[model samples]
Target: MNQNRVQASEVAPRAGLADISILANASLTSVTGTDMTSNAQGSYDLALKYSGTGLASVGVADKKVLVYALPAELQGKVVGGATVDIDANLLPITPGDIPGVSLLFGALGTAIDGVDKLVAIPAVKAAFDSLSTIQNLGAYQETLPATVSPDGKTISVDFTQGFGKYVHQAYVALFDTLRDTIAAIDVKNPIAAIPVKLLQEASADLFAIIDAIADGTSDILDNALNANLLGSMNGTLHTTVSDPGVASATVKAGAINNALISADVLTATEQEGEAVTLNFPTTAVNPIENYDVAAPVITQPVAGQTQVAGQVTLTQPIPDGTTFEAVVTLPDGSTKNVPLAADGTFVVDTGSLVDGQTISAKVVATNGTYTKDSPITTATVTAAPIENPIADYNVATPSVAPLTAGDPEITGQVTLNQPIPLGTTFEAVATLPDGSQLTGTVESDGTFKSAGVDQLAAGQTVTNG
Candidate 1:
């Protein structure tokens, strides 16, 4: 369980898109760790040098830059219960100078007002309620208010762990709930003159897009954390942003996949100004190792004539609070884990194993403190006995009898000493006293019936084959 914390230096933050001039020379300088409640707090220091035409030209006034750590990527690396904090020193643009920032906030308020009015309509309210019950129609946000720095030149982004995963879970849960709800709705009913069936279809299409966005975003986040930038300076940093124009800038953009980081901004701005310095920091973590233990005993398996597989047993008994997992490796290099029964017996399915194929098996035993694997046992799969085909033979005895009293129709049975193959049928022919032949099919069980035996007399001699 020993591991090392991933450093921000390992992943260089790419500058915002080339079109975003304000972020021309943005780059991560260093990442430092501080002891937190359960684990260390990850702090990333980034510097963005202004190299654009001007903040006035970019319409970015009062727009706060954001940086977020991906919790999905840090699951086993950090302890939970750590709070995420954003330092107030990252915003350099002056709030008073940006008049458009007010306009942006005003526009957002107007949009909210419009939504409130729409929700007042009975039909609209029902639809909205339906969506809300399935999932939060509103965007997911855990607002942590941060103020602009007085000087506004240096920005430090610190996110410990857990929060990003919570956000991710919220998103996944929303989509999953919505998908399930839509699937359960009765499609035959009409809502607002539109068939509910159509809504279900539209939901399926929407889910496809959501899945792509969710999976792609997760991949980008994962790549940002684990990408091997061993020797290359090019790397991607995960980030988030806040702006007056939207409830949560990251949510408005549909997620942090499009957040602006300093690496690319720094690189681009440096080409226009002086070189910016970059620093990388790293930390190590170690976990306790398990003590060595003894391996379990294994028993060989034998293929049976009727079964496609063989039974492999654990001859030795296990102690309480212990568990064992057995894995079998076939000659083709495929491995299968077989679960043991209460008696410690497991079936090694060799139906797919070719003739003369060899197999090896081992058992891993785990107690409260340690896990140990048993010695590998190898054996050739035993071939099952070949079955002989049913021998061909003629019916030993064929006889006829009256099916009912005073009736010409008759029923009879043929006899054989050996077992009859299933689905086997035979044609039964009988010669009546009038020299006419009556024929019927004999079932595999040797039973048959025939009609139109008008000349048949009881107790009279009749020929049959």
Candidate 2:
């Protein structure tokens, strides 16, 4: 038998039998030759074996291959010339001669044919193409060597291949998809549960979902807690207390509301068709019992009145033992305080008030923290009456001048104790020489000159009529 005989070129080109290597003892060798012997004319039994070994350290070892041949007719015969002419042929063989090898080869060939048929299917081919594309993706192609932990419960993935740069994008994309899916779910009628397989496959994503739900619940609770009904009621009570009549009620109501909220009996949110009733305890004291006192009202010396007697009176009666003071604003812009009498009436002296001057006065209840002022009242001072002027007539020294005629003319000036009226005339009569009258108009200086006095003698007494 020629053990190193190369196979005829016809067998070398057959599909699934080309360029095959079988490994043994941690080494690889190619099936480069065949052992054959002629059992009879035109008949042969052949056996194939691989030779050589690969590196044991690389883990490519202890591998073997089995070959089986089939007896079949050739379509063409070899010519007797130097160049042989042959045609392609198909063969059929009986497998009883090397049952072990035949069975193994049969099983492997069946499996390969089945795989070939599956790959030929269009849908399967498309699925394989998609898988190939995914495998080639930048994110997936970045591989990490996996390491088992010491206790075998955890595996660590290597991060030497720029894992964060690529894998983070994939993680972000996955989370975005998950967020969108959750957002599309209707909260009113949400799905009962996530699919178990999906949860198992994406536990990280499920954790994210749980976190989102927890955050939303926390926000809702925060908002509810912040809507403090007790606080709001307290504010309302503060505003209501400004009105003295409702102060006691508002305070009691606020206390009750606070107690209810503290006891969790009241919700922060307003409920429809429900009212919060605040009941005060029987022993609760009224807050505004002493707040009934008000600012005094002045009615006696009415506004815009002239006080001839320079006194003011208040008509509104005060309680017994309640003393009040009046703030009087004089016309000169100065202020004075006057005490009220026991009857709530106050008198203001007009000594400081000028005639015809207007003054403002307001009454302030005194001797208590609740003291308040009344509305301002205005009054004018009375004008003084005019006095009549007095008049007195007096005699003046007479002077006589010698005239060319028979009698000398007498001239004299008369004076009055007070000035006379502008249009009044004064006259003097002398009885020494002749009965004659002398008259002159009085001037503003209370002096009068008697002019054109004819036949007037010296030292003659001049009298006015």
Best by TM-score: 1
lDDT of each: 0.39, 0.31
Score candidate 2 by TM-score against the native.
0.20
Q: Candidate 2, residues 378-416: lDDT per residue as tens digits?
A: 765654555343344343443333333324333444445
Per-structure clash totals for the candidates: 14, 8
Candidate 1 accuracy as TM-score? 0.26
lDDT for 163 (candidate 1): 33
lDDT of 1 by residue, 1-465 (tens): 123435644675554334442232333321222111111112222222211112222221213233322211222222111222322111122211123222432332343234434333234234324433323312223333322222322122222122334333444444464455445443332332243434444445554544543554433222222211111111112222111121111100001122344454433433432222322222321111232223333344345422123233544333323466677776778888876566555565555545566777777666445556767777665666675444565557787764433567657888855666675568788776677888888876787776777743457666678
Task: Assess the local accuracy of residue 332 in candidate 2 as a C-alpha lDDT between 0 and 100.
Answer: 68
Work out the TM-score per prediction: 0.26, 0.20
lDDT of 2 at 211: 46
